[model samples]
Target: MKIKKVKPYNQEEDKTKQLSRMFNTISSKYDQFNDIMSMGLARVWRKKAILSLKPYKHDTILDIAAGTADIGIKAFEYITPTQITGIDVSEKMLEIGKEKVAEAGLNDKISLKVEDVSKMNFADESFDAAITSFGIRNFDKLEESIREVHRVLKPKGKFVILEMSEPRMPIVKQGYLLYTHTLIPFAVKTFSNDPKAYKYLTKSMEAFPQGKEFIAILNQNGFNCLKYKTFFMGVCSLYVIEKYSS
Candidate 1:
């Protein structure tokens, strides 16, 4: 299956470049906007994502698209990991993440960097576990990014992902469509200068392949033991997978 590209501003430029600019534009209010949009339930979603890690004392974790280090911070709190590295394409977002990391007094335990997932610099088997929350849909090349993630993880390394998904129940699906199409954009316009960014958010979430299709993609990219759980009647999905190495 071909991956559909969603540009932040509907610009003709590269999706990565557009996405970086979009995140930078909204980095300041990103957290607040998330709370408002999700009715403060996004935090619960992130907490669930972190719990899926099953971290060990010596675990070295890589948080892909680690916007503002929320997942990384939670990993430290829950897993008490030896070290956590978060990588994202948005420098401005990473800058905010650095401040949050310091404020949490976790600067010594966590590091955030500006790095593209599709072309990561990490060596093979660099991390014991990897995760991304609401980040996979923005990848310009989904398959390449997945392959890069597979390359950096150790044998049998765990991979956990949280992302928005279309609801399956008829009632929930109708409500979700109305929320994303009307309510979300209205909220974005009222609260943010980057309305296009949220527009892209809804568009991308709708276009993204979920459930079994997503599992198939992960299996094809060297990740195995794929499993997923749906939340809010499938409005969101949490995927737990592991790397397979010979």
Candidate 2:
């Protein structure tokens, strides 16, 4: 399937570059905006995503698109990961994340780097587990990024993804659409310096493949869907997939 590419500025630059710029632009207020936009549900969702990794060997975890290092920081609360290596394209975002990690005295346990997932420098089977939260949709090369995750993960290692998706039900879908299309943009404009970033974010969420479609993509990229769960009327989804042993 040919997914429509949604860029923040809709410019000639590639999505990765545009996304890096967009996140960097909004890095300061990104966490604040998330809290207001999701009404604190994002915290619950992040905890759930992290807790799902408990059954696996997640000692050395790789966090993809680890913006603000939320997932890495929170992983400490739910699981006993020895180390978490977070990679993101936005340097500014990582800077803030580093500050948070330092303040939490987690500087030694978590490391944040400015690296693209599609072209990571990690070796084969470098991590015991890999995870991403609300970040896969922005991949400029989604397939390649998935493939990279597969390559870096140990055999049968888990790769969990937490992402936003449109609700499937009738009444819930109506309310979700209203909230995303109306209130989300309004909130961004009122609170963020880069309103266009959230505009691109909503557009990307709409265009990106979700649910079964996303499972199919993962299957083709050397992963097997282990568990699929939707929260809050499918507004967000958690996909737990494992690398093929063979």
Candidate 3:
């Protein structure tokens, strides 16, 4: 079966541009919204993902699609990397991220830039580790973006991703669908001016490949030692993989 492309805005603009505009519209309220919607479970998921990179220290880490820099800031808590570089298409998101970095007294360790993942600006093999949180589903060219991430990661570099997934348990699946299709959209409508953005988020999650299928995509993109774990009865997951050295 052919997969349909899931995009925000559903306009002529590409997914990247639409995502930027959508994120910028909610950048200021992003963190608060997350807390309310997830009931603080998102932080737990992020902490687990960051722990996967704890064994590496003094390495340069890339936080791709690092909206608001939450993942990057959390990275600092688990590992003392020499430098943390964050890139996102949303300039406003990066702006808020910069402020958070400085407020945390991590300005010296972290930097934020506006960059597209499908065509990243970093030189090949520039980063020792990379992490992205809930960001891959927004990529217009999923495989192509993974290839770019692989290109910049050093040999044996770790790439960890935290993203939403569907629950496998039958009852959980029903509840999950209800929360996403109705409750999430309603919450977005109440809390955010751009409810369509959250609606697109739910749609994108539904369209994205998960579990073993997603691992196959990573392997095909030159990632090795791929492993994944699910949380909240598979409502979310963490994929930990590495770049092939040889």
Candidate 4:
């Protein structure tokens, strides 16, 4: 089945442009909104995603869609990567992320930039490992972005991704839907600068391919799936993929 393409707004702009504007609008409250939506489990999930790269060579890491540097900041707690380079399309988001990195005494360790994953300027084989947390669903050209990531990583380099997913268990699915569609929207409307952003986020999650379907995308883009695991009854998923050595 062909997956539906979702955009933050109903206008003529592409997903990348719309997403950048949407995130910039809500960048200040993005972390708080995440806390409310995940009930604080976002941190735990991010920790796990970063730790998944611990066994690999991660001296230099690329953090894709690194909004507010959450994954980049959390990496220091789980592993000893010498440097982390974060890229995002939203300048405001990266502005806030830079502040946080400085405050966390990571100013020298982490760097934030405004760049799109699909068109990175870095040379090939630039990183030992790469990671993205709750960000893949927003990729306008998923395959192109994945291919870029593959190109930037050294042979055998690991790429870890953490993303929200629809629950498959009957009971869990019902509860998940209720929380996402009803509670999340209500909360966003009540507290967010752009209420419609969460609506797009939820809709995108529903339309995104999951499980084996997503694994297939990785495999086709020069990545070999090493592990796939779900958290909280499949509300979230973690993917660990490696670049083919050859």
lDDT of each: 0.88, 0.93, 0.88, 0.93
Tell me the TM-score of each prediction against the true structure: 0.96, 0.98, 0.96, 0.98
lDDT by residue for model 2 (151-175), tens: 9999999999999899989999999
RMSD of 4: 1.0
Model 2 regions more than 4 Å off: none
Question: On residues 1-246, what C-alpha lDDT tens digit does candidate 4 reach at each position?
Answer: 466889998757898999999999999999998988999999999999999999999999999999999888889988999999999999999999999998899999999999999999999999999999989999998999999999999989999999999999999999999988789888877898888898998999999999999998888889999999999999999999999854
Write the number of the candidate with greater TM-score, choosing between 3 and 4: 4
Superposition TM-score, candidate 4 onto the true structure: 0.98
Error of 4 at 28 (Å): 0.8
Candidates' RMSD to native = 1.3, 0.8, 1.4, 1.0
Per-residue CA lDDT of candidate 1, range 1-246, in tens? 986776877558999999999999999999999888888888899889888876432379999999899999877776657899999999999999999999999988899989999999899989988999999989999999998999999888888889989998899899999998889888887888777888888899998999999999998998875568998889889998988874
Error of 3 at 103 (Å): 0.5
| By TM-score: ranked, best first | 2, 4, 1, 3
